[model samples]
Target: MTIPTARTTAPFDAVLCDLDDVIRLFDATEVTRLERAAGLPVGSTAASAFGPGRGGPLVLGQLSKDAWAESTARGLADRVPAARARELAAAFARAPFRTDPEVVELLRAARARCPVWIVTNGTPWLDEDLATLDLDGLADGIVNSARLGVAKPDPGILLHAAGRAGAAPERCLFVDDRAANVEAAAALGMATVHFRTAADLRPALAPLLARPVPHPRR
Candidate 1:
């Protein structure tokens, strides 16, 4: 599908973007590797760590990082020693978080034009994760689900992100790798871009950057 462009008439005052699969890449292979190394079957780590019963509370701020790690370790204790499970959990928590230079450049350009906010459904260590990628200063603001006690596909976090950008929901442009999140923002009257790659993102954001910023009323 073609990338959707922002409306030129109203124009967006800010950009709200997702973290994983957009700014930072999450390696599924690494998770599988960790699972195997821990003597569990493939996908076991992901299922136990991110699956409904375990990771839901972590993402929603109900569980602390240590608690989530301990929970994940417990889930693996049958296959691996409890100590090894904890080690695996630590490795998973410290998984490679790399930033795309192209996306970073694009975000920097976008930030220069208007406010840019990182709106992500992440764990309790969201800030630490961003710091690892040197992405802490890239955006004007960050709204993490783990910290907010809400997540996307729920309009509250989107509205909260826009508020953090100091822009009204309708005046913000939201970009996410997930279709559900894009649709959720669009439902709230915000312009949405379903981001697939950096190439697609540039064109989607070009019009917003090219448009003249509206002056404040005297």
Candidate 2:
């Protein structure tokens, strides 16, 4: 990766943001329907799908999405039939997600001042999802744990993200919905936004958003 030279003026030279629950939100309707049809509880699919034993390998790039789905199915084998469990797992795994427009706009505004990188613990299809959201190029770069064989709360991934953003950890603003991820970034000397609503980002990014983008000298 070609890391850019950090610009000195902005409060944050880079914005390292999370993807799931922060930018992309999943629709649980299909998963709910599948679980209900299989006589399972609403959160059962999610519980199995996201559990470390089943989902960890997928995020760490050790397992393919299909393999993860199969693992999740096996996790629910005692509760449902093999075929039904597989159906539920597949539906949950492939659940649709949408971008938070308000957050996207704010990030775009911040990008006018400095690079914005999506740093996330995500599956290999992460880029394809970004493309579906029309956000492929919204961020200057992306640091996907599935691609890197590491996940958040791990200092190495955060450091890799900061490097990709071309900023020292202290000069980057890390925004994530998870407190653990935020704390990890803070410990690395990066400013953090433990995001909840789009409003949570306004103040943290206000300094950069308020400034006008400078035109290149001809």
Top candidate, metric TM-score: 2
Per-residue C-alpha lDDT of model 1 across residues 81-194, encoded as one tens digit per residue: 888888777777666768878888888877767889999998887776666667755798789898898988899999888888989898998989999999999999998889
Lowest-sum lDDT 10-residue window in model 2:
209-218
Clashing pairs in 2: none
TM-score of every candidate relative to the true structure:
0.80, 0.90
Worst 10 residues of 1 by lDDT: 209-218
Q: What is each predicted model's overall lDDT from 0 to 1?
A: 0.81, 0.88
**Candidate 1 clash pair list:** none
Q: Where in model 2 is the C-alpha error above 4 Å? A: 1-9, 216-218
lDDT of 1: 0.81
Model 2 over residues 1-218: C-alpha lDDT tens digits? 99999666778789999989988889999889888888888899889987878667878878777888998998899999999999998888789889899998899877777889999998887777777787854788889999999998899999999998888999999999999999999999999999999999999999988788966312
